[model samples]
Target: MAPRNKEQEAEVLSWIFEVLGEKVPSGQYEDILKDGIVLCKLINKIAPGSVKKIQERGTNFQLMENVQRFQAAIKKYGVPEEEIFQTADLFERRNIPQVTLCLYCLGRITQKHPEYTGPGLGPKMADKNERTFTEEQLRAHEGELNLQMGFNKGASQSGHGGFGNSRHM
Candidate 1:
């Protein structure tokens, strides 16, 4: 498991509580979110009716289903698949940092929905700036080598010893 950041986890918790219109409580982050109820509530708050039925009290499998539902809803709401955390990450306490990262991504993705005017989590997401180019403009740079590719300037390792041998002056 990766090292967990207390500050980031606190921030995500605060954001979740704020979105749910509940007061932030001083408690274990994983324990608070283990049941996945808060997660479902958070996503539903962002996107109403995203999760049709949230199992309030049930077996472990039912609770895990809530996490899965939240995952699917977030993916449908534009959160990237790679950014979403697995059920075990939150439930089994496998990787809390990943869970925090997933929440942060969910908060950042809220910018995609203009209707979401609630409290945000991390830095504001940048809007897409697309620039179109004409065919002539693209062809002009086809034969030209990009400077970012690095200029070797005819330098080569012709005199260098094979492998790790030291070169004597």
Candidate 2:
């Protein structure tokens, strides 16, 4: 496959976001991991089977095997292992930050591997909305927020648990 042109890349991103929008917490793109099956399918469409085995491994009887397969694929495919592990770790917790990290990892893959991206469509393009976050608006409570933003600071990835009454994997 050829690397996607801007138009083609945009379309693929749109489709992924559209699917994610419906499958996840409405407009919450970060919550993509909350519905791992759907996100895995979309990721597979772009990366070709990179995560298919992961969906099956998510449940009982093969957690370790599934973890290994998932780790291997991400490591081999150039995704940052830190982000991938963060996705699962956060996923088990079902918190907002985990969703954020998951989106980042998937976005990095599609952006980096344009050849594997989708071909362009005619004129029917993805929807668009615009918003701006200034330095202050985007980064309030700078000190505390920074400390709590990553995969580890807020929760332990060792088991499934959610913060405050948030969703639980």
Candidate 3:
């Protein structure tokens, strides 16, 4: 199916979050569980291949169609129950505490995995301020900046160089 346009997408997303925040409101519990599934799918879309990994590693999640091996593998790998249960807890439970934990863990997992490095989700950059700059690199960058701005103090003083709009008061 073709994707929804931006306005439609915004409305749907807004509805989901607003409904999820409700406490024992007019909705059915079963419907809420279905909403959780939709939310899980959206999260998977954001971090591709995550649903498969979650199935394989999310130990406490109980949807057992083709998940037998993952159940075994998760235990074998010694991944904690808490680590594995984010998706399931979000879908199956939908409690506020579980939802909070699931979102936190999902963010952590996506940040840790290399395949999730896309767009704004790229691997964290080390602070440039924390890194030591060699004098040669510093000089090169300075020269590049000067060239970028077409700046030359000596040429300017000789009155033969300018932005052509440099007015002296």
Poorest 10 consecutive residues of model 1 by lDDT? 144-153
| lDDT of candidates 1 onward, in order | 0.92, 0.50, 0.42
- The candidate with the higher TM-score, 2 or 3, is 2
Model 1 alpha-carbon drift over 4 Å, by segment: 132-169
RMSD of each: 3.8, 20.3, 14.5
Model 3 lDDT tens row, 49-153: 434533322334444322333323433333346645444433454343444333334444444446644332213544336678788877786534555477565
In model 1, state the lDDT of residue 38: 91
Query: Judged by lDDT against the true structure, how good is candidate 2?
Result: 0.50
TM-score of each: 0.79, 0.40, 0.30
Residues 15-134, candidate 1, lDDT per residue (tens digit)?
Answer: 999999999877799989998899999999999999999999999999999999999999999999999998999899988899999999999999878999899989988878999999
User: Which of candidates 1 and 2 is the stronger one according to TM-score?
Assistant: 1
For model 2, what is the error of residue 169's alpha carbon versus the real structure, in angstroms, after optimal superposition?
A: 75
Given candidate 2, what's the lDDT at residue 11? Answer: 41
For each of the candidates, give the backbone clash count. 0, 0, 0
Candidate that would win on TM-score: 1
